[model samples]
Target: MKVTRLLGSGVELADGSRIAAGTVIWTGGMRASALTEQGSGQRDPLGRLHVALDLSVTGAAHVYAAGDVTLAATDDHGNHAMMACQHAIDMGRYAGHNVAADLLGLPTMPYQQPFYVTCLDLGGAGAVYTEGWHREVKLTGADPARSVVA
Candidate 1:
């Protein structure tokens, strides 16, 4: 699918809904709302159920989170993905490592996300891989090579 780089609060259609926090809220395939203000006291009680990554799950550990939903957390353990598939792949690997390390009592790994990549299909026969989801995508850093690295 083709995605557009929305500016400002985000792009919306004829209606009045908005998507903020870089999330794409859609209606019948059109963007309805985007995150204008991320983690604005929005809490999902359900998210509290996710298992936390602590220094030790054996009831003693220094667990922490670094992501968008940290503010809205009702309890512990809440985070948002990279909003891109590349980061998903990266996070998947990191999650596996954490599980193995914690289970085997092995060392833990640090989370390091490079960036994001997007494939935009132009017209009928052209595509571009960008590093970010903004207008500055054409800058020196947004080169296709950077996307390939992701």
Candidate 2:
């Protein structure tokens, strides 16, 4: 469970053990971008900075986080924001809008996206269009949904 040395040829463990290997790959959980640490706020286990419904960093009025740097609510039902591209774009818009409003002394709107959708290409099987968090298929292959995407 412990690695004392790791060289291109092999690895050495703390117990004076050596194992020859071709390559070593390290896989671990995701962490938020280092930029998230610029603000003083809480973070989730994934290291994503916590934010309010408005996407403002908790306890940091001048700090706002969006996209993958933040842990934001995705809907009123309490789903957390995802790191996917669609969710990132959604959060980015809210963060920008709220920041502008704060600068202009205007009311800020709460960020919420109750619906989610995805379109995936299945190669020879064509593509599929799915809706909602459950990923219910609404269209497949050459269906009109595919046309809509086109």
Candidate 3:
């Protein structure tokens, strides 16, 4: 049921089937790029490289991975980083810092993002905003829209 393209009124599936509708909301999934295969490291089912606390590739020396390519622990509660910009941005920052720190012979900091939030657009119905990994709904309907504008 993979979506190959989003039509003006609907979506086209990978099987070449098309569905017509008035609205379509696509929350695409993520997968690591082919470049990750070139590295010698353990990969998750999604092909994300298993990374150390310092964001370094687990089995590759001096090589670091970040963003959607690496699967790093987000916190001590066993939550791993997702392949989203929210996690990727912070992962990139930590990876950059750790890489420089490694080269300079300085202690590198562990990557940690304890807080998580999600804002999902519902098209004409407005949006939904949630906080934390449990996804506790903080706002809905036009409230999320107003908050975004404000």
In TM-score terms, which candidate is top?
Answer: 3
Residue-level lDDT tens digits of model 1 in 43-122: 33323112233211222243323233222111133333433445445555655676677678787775554344566544
Error of 3 at 123 (Å): 2.5
Which ten contiguous residues of candidate 2 have the minimum total lDDT? 141-150
* Per-residue accuracy of model 2 over 30-120 as CA lDDT, tens digit each: 6788877666688887789888889889998867788888898888777887878888998889899999999999988899988888787
Ranking by lDDT: 3, 2, 1
| Two-way lDDT contest, 1 vs 3, winner | 3
The reply for model 2, stretches above 4 Å from the true place, is: 1-30, 142-149
Clashes of each: 9, 0, 0
Give the Cα error of residue 53 in candidate 2, in Å.
0.9
* The 10-residue segment with the lowest total lDDT in model 1: 66-75
Which candidate comes out best when scored by lDDT? 3
lDDT of 3 by residue, 61-143 (tens): 88999999889999999999988989999999999999999999999999999999899876678999999999999999988
